[model samples]
Target: MALFEQIRVRLPRGARADAALAGGVFVLVAFPEGKLLGHGGDPLPSRVVSWLLVIVVCGALLFRRRYPVAVGWFTVVGTGAYYVLSDVDGPLVLVPIVALYAIAAQGRMQAAIAMAAAMVIGVGAATLTTASDVTGTAVFMLTGWLVAVVALGSGRHGRLAYAEEEARLRATEERLRIARELHDVIGHNISMINVQSGAALHRLKKDPAQAEAALSAIKAGSRDTLQELRATLDVLRRVDEDAPRAPTPGLARVDTLVGSANLAGLAVRIERTGAERALPARVDLAAYRIVQESLTNVARHSGAGHVTIRLAYGDRELTVAVEDDGRMTARPARPGGGSGIAGMTERARALGGELAAGPRPEGGFVVRARLPYGITGERWSGAADDQGPAGG
Candidate 1:
């Protein structure tokens, strides 16, 4: 196998390579160094005719990849003609076998099988016509060789198809990841900027002092948006490994979210339960994004006065719930709403977690997510219903 790989690496590629290979094969069969294997009979034709037949049989291989099935049949019939015309039964037989493999490798299984069958039948008929002692064992061995060649070629085709499919799936997953990141980065900051700008416009004439403060907050929010946007784009444009990278958002930066929510006119409070411990990076990022998206939705839709964010760190999982004590405004969702709770749910589910968002019976809406540390083998042992505000 190592020698084969070395040869493959050194070989020329594409159509010219096939032409060179065909020429080499023709030379090996036509002018072998050793005596040629004969069919133990008197030659029935001229030596020139035999060489012409050899050329026709071996020359068909140059177009094997482009016209595999046609070349396969031509080589099969040509090999039989060569054996019948000349007493020589040499490496000329290898050309048809190579053509059969090419047919199978091009994903033409039925054509390869039919060709094999024809070749087997032709050989069996020739054994009957000639007085040679060709045994059943020889015929079976030839069939086995044909079967193995077809299997190898088909396996190569299957592996190539599987690699293509895997590449396509990875590309799709990357696209989805980029979409989610852009949505989270741009959606939240833009929501905050929109709210602050509205407040600034409303208070511009009645109270210029309050208007100035709102304008300042808007300016700051827009600047932060630009910085975060640049950071996100830098991550996407990662062409060099040694380049500086901003830290990914995680629960450690939840304070920044709270401060942003405070500026959005909602009093935000954070409560932690259970023993605080370090979380896996995926779980940490998922938890942060869930909370970030929930806060953005609350600021946009719910006219709430106070919001409570509860974080429960369990032995194997983490629960994050954002509840508000505000009026639940039944606003119709706009087309292509990025700040809705669906994106949060998708994030949680991607981490082997679940999220629930609904209007609480007591007051405003609530979003609860349960994220697991490891998403394999063991199932989550925590109580399933504890993801709500009442339990967590």
Candidate 2:
């Protein structure tokens, strides 16, 4: 088997040479009487013609691999002619067998079968005409050549199957990797914004001056978050030339997001807990989207008068929760009921995190998500607050 594998590897460049050498050897061995110089006890022109036939048969063997179908037919004709003219069993007769196997391996099964049939008919006719004892030779050659074609074809198909399976596995792995990165970028940002926005609102009643500054900070933070998201999305979209340019929103932008809801006459509140820390880009992005999608759902379905968003960071994970105090009966059915929920679930699942969204026991609807910190053990620290809130 190892020797056969080595020969198969070398066959691409060496097949033609091998065929020529084998035919030369056959000619020398078959015409041991010095090319039949004399016939019926005297020299004749037929002797020279017979030698020429051997040369033609050997020459035809050189082109088999480059054009296997043509070579098979040429060999069939040449071998039959040589068998009749020279009364010789030349090695050129095996050319069609190799050519048929090549054709079948290359997915040309019908052509290979046709050539095999031609070989059988030609060999049978030549054997009958010459009255030679070729019955065993003919049977062995036909059966062996057919088996070789079937084996080669099956091997080629198996190789293709393996290649396809490998490609599929690679594609699946890539998708999982991308999903993890996306979760890290989006999750952390949304948590931070939700926290800060809630703090700003709480301080509004106590100090109007600080409230104005906080609102301004919120707008700037939201804008910055959107820009950063756009940049990250651009990198992910490298494979798509026509992908749209849309910025991603992060948690720092929750105030502006909630403000928009306020403008639409929905009362929204945001709150945060724990010491604020800078998160990886993926976590920030996921956090922002969770809040954003939650608020969007509230606007679309709920006739809620108030919505509350909360963000909390523990030692190992970040959690986000959004709830509304709207009456369930007042909420309308979502235009496409399950699509938004499915999309949200898919987004959360991609990040290697968990999301929960449904009606709250007290009243209204709720969305909760928890994302793990320390992606692959990479720790993220808080950035300096020197820049404006919009500079994330």
Question: TM-scores of all models?
Answer: 0.85, 0.46
Q: Candidate 2: how many backbone clashes?
A: 28
Over the full model, what C-alpha lDDT does candidate 1 score relative to the true structure?
Answer: 0.76
lDDT by residue (171-211, candidate 2, tens digit) is: 77555434433333343334335544765787779977666
Quote the lDDT for 16 in model 2: 57
What is the per-residue lDDT of model 1 for residues 1-392, given as tens digits with 9 covering 90 to 100? 99888788566778987798789888888775125534344354545667788888888888887888999999999988877876565668788898888888878999999999998888888888887567678878989999999999899989888999987976676566666666776777788778767777888899898778877877777787787677656655765454333455678989888887776677999999999988876777778878887787788878887999999999989999999977873433635755367767777776678899888888788888998878642222211211101100
Task: Write down the lDDT of every candidate, Cα atoms only.
Answer: 0.76, 0.62
Badly placed stretches (over 4 Å) of model 2 are 1-248, 329-333, 336-338, 374-392
Error of 1 at 211 (Å): 3.2
Candidate 2, residue 117: Cα displacement in angstroms equals 14
lDDT of 2: 0.62
- Total backbone clashes of candidate 1, pairs 3 or more residues apart or in separate chains: 0
